[model samples]
Target: MKLTEVQEILAKSSQEDWIVDDESGSFTYKNDLNLHIDRADFDSYREFNEPWATSHPDPHAVSVEYVVKYGSSFVDKHTLVSVDGHRATLPMPKSINDLRVTESDVNFAKIVNIGDRVDEYLKRARLVEVEDNE
Candidate 1:
């Protein structure tokens, strides 16, 4: 992606709540969670917050709103149910690298697994064996 495009994504992501994704298809609360920690652990997250805040300054602090808008072609519209009972159209990136198509872009359509909740994805079954002697 072009520097401009990356800057746009960074701006938009900074505005909203962000979720972190592991390259291996897992999701987590921390951006680098998959690198050196357990997927279920978040105790260290707070330890990094202050340092992160100091190290990474907000781009918007410098009056850089232009860095957040993207071309129409890069975004996809999704209908979400609002609390007011109205369907709201939300703009989402069609691809991870929506600003520029890349070989590393994940094909969300193939992995979304719609209608399946994370609990359902985590459910498992155990097998039991019986012996005739018993």
Candidate 2:
């Protein structure tokens, strides 16, 4: 999605909700406070699930929670983890929706307690943008 479109969506959505309009995929949040991306897409609504859960029928992987820490220009401050098990702190993605590595300043790291379970969250916990240089 273009920046104009994302701005439009954000403008239309409520403050309690953050519409993650991007090129890769889109998901909306009730607010930035909670880490869980509630499955409330109007057409369908359900509980948030882990990206790897397959016992029932949901495309979500694991319930990953993230903590965004603010730091200086060259440091990362995002920590991601499962609501239940496993944890991985990732560097922010440079752009939202689209998973493109466009900047050399924003670095991303992946640490997993489990195999590929943490990968899901790490992928989703992308680098939104680089803070403007003041």
Candidate 3:
């Protein structure tokens, strides 16, 4: 499979919300959740503002962490969802390197699995990208 084909599949499956950032050389999906994918390496995290502490007048206590939660803050603290193990490397054809299509690109099925993982992550995060009909 070619890189372009993979990009097209992700774009369609993600409702065109997944965009390729040429400068970063990675695919970025930003909605309520923010995801950055570089080759088989990807990072998923959410950003939100934490309530201000009583001692501090500032209310902009921003926090970022994986979407999945584990236990209470005093216990295990928030942890990553077990998406087939943390940072599970999605299968990709060896022909593809750094999101660039090599001359020997093949294995269409593996390329498709990459898209599947992306969709799965979005779903696991309680986010289903859908077209805005309005």
Off by over 4 Å in 2: 1-58, 61-63, 66-76, 79-92, 101-109, 116-134
Per-residue accuracy of model 1 over 31-57 as CA lDDT, tens digit each: 322211112222311221221112222
For each candidate in the order shown, give its overall lDDT on alpha carbons.
0.21, 0.31, 0.29
Q: Write the per-residue lDDT of candidate 2 for residues 13-118, one digit (tens) a residue.
A: 4323544432322333344322222222233322344322322222432333322221211112232222222243233233334443322222222221223333
Predictions ranked by lDDT, top down?
A: 2, 3, 1
Model 3 CA deviation exceeding 4 Å by range = 1-116
TM-score to true structure, per model = 0.16, 0.21, 0.21
* Candidate 1 RMSD to the correct structure: 21.0
Best by lDDT: 2
Tell how far residue 81 is off in model 2, in angstroms.
8.1
Q: What C-alpha lDDT does candidate 1 achieve relative to the native structure?
A: 0.21
- Candidates 2 and 3 compared: the better one by lDDT is 2
Clashing pairs in 1: none
Off by over 4 Å in 1: 2-69, 85-134
Clashes per model (N, Cα, C within 3 A): 0, 14, 0
Q: How many backbone clashes does candidate 2 have?
A: 14
Evaluate residue 15 in candidate 3 and report its C-alpha lDDT on the 0 to 100 scale. Answer: 24
